[model samples]
Target: MNSLPPLRQPCPPGTCTCRRDELLEEPGADLRILRLTRHEEQRLLERLENIRSLADLERLQQRMYEQLGIRLSVSPSHNEVRSMRGIVIDFVEQPGLCRKTRQAIPAAIRRGLERQPEIAYRLLDAHDLLRDA
Candidate 1:
């Protein structure tokens, strides 16, 4: 009588049979996408680790910001943001990259936080960009 999650594990004794993750059971774990798989983290984080300089990091940063629907800057460093799902994502970036957010952060943008906590992604209401409110 409802919908199913897009991601999944093998049917025959897979590593995690967690269709109902403990995290999701927590309070405020809205229907937003706040979960990550180890495999995905490995793939994307690999690219992030290859960054050779601040410029490179900035380039990736820009791509992520623009492509991800985040168009607001609320700080000098990539501290964190909360998506419409209400999950707080933390990012670690340069001194002036300026973490961004907008109407609502997409679920896939959690890459910044999943890999190394180096960068976090959270969507904020364009009108309510708070510093962890």
Candidate 2:
């Protein structure tokens, strides 16, 4: 009588093992916190696509700060089995925050995700230094 919904209600076939597998957002949860102009996002994606190594990621991190006033972090994936790694971007400037931004950023929402051996720019959600305060 756990009476709890599955990770994914009506889970997709083959993804759930009746243990702990599938997960999904509620019916109407728009998790996209921040958004960039189409051109800005496209430019970011282009740089992400160029990440061929960790060094590249580091450079991108720097670039994100200088270009877009956003802090970006890249790290190796702990999951050896997975093909890629991860990156974390917090819009704040505290403990885990990035201390630099080359531009004056307007208020907005933002989030960060991870990268692998190759760079893949993925935005889970977004926050900000001022926003969080």
Candidate 3:
């Protein structure tokens, strides 16, 4: 069983802020705080539409690194990382790949690759390159 102390919020003159932690602790609380503004949301949606495959993923990663300097990569699962890297390398060696073949890459990574193209791509590429022989 998980137990945490009740949260206490800073009090203003005759006013109290809700304890965010306590609220989050409640079962089935669906509270979400939006971190991005409207423009950011629109940009993210647009970027997501452009990602297609491993090359696109790479490009997106590079774009992110240049723009925001955040690095994204695959988890440290040996087999999955190796497989993804192979796909990326294959795409690199051969350009003008068919859309059907490109579709084989995972959609989640594709979307991520789109959102912050540069950084995510570099991190993923580096991870793929360094994890194995």
Best by TM-score: 2
Candidate 2 Cα RMSD after full superposition onto the native fold (Å): 17.1
**Cα-based lDDT at residue 93, candidate 3:** 19
lDDT score, candidate 3, position 12: 45
The residue-by-residue lDDT of candidate 2 on 1-133, one tens digit each, is 6763222123255543322121123444321212234445555655565455545555776766664445544333333224222332334331211111111121111111232422232221222213334
The candidate scoring highest on lDDT is 3
Order of candidates by lDDT, top first? 3, 1, 2
RMSD of 3: 16.2
Model 3 poorest ten-residue lDDT run: 89-98
Error of 3 at 118 (Å): 20
Candidate 2 clashing pairs, residues 3+ apart or interchain: 85-115, 85-116, 86-114, 86-115, 87-114, 110-125, 110-126, 110-127, 111-125, 111-126
Model 1 error, position 17 (Å) = 18
- Clash count, candidate 2: 10
Question: Could you arrange the candidates by TM-score from highest to lowest?
Answer: 2, 3, 1
Error of 3 at 31 (Å): 27
Cα lDDT for residue 54, candidate 1: 34
Clashes of each: 7, 10, 11
**Which ranges in model 1 have alpha carbons more than 4 Å from their true place?**
1-22, 26-34, 59-133
Residue 94 miss distance in model 3 (angstroms): 34
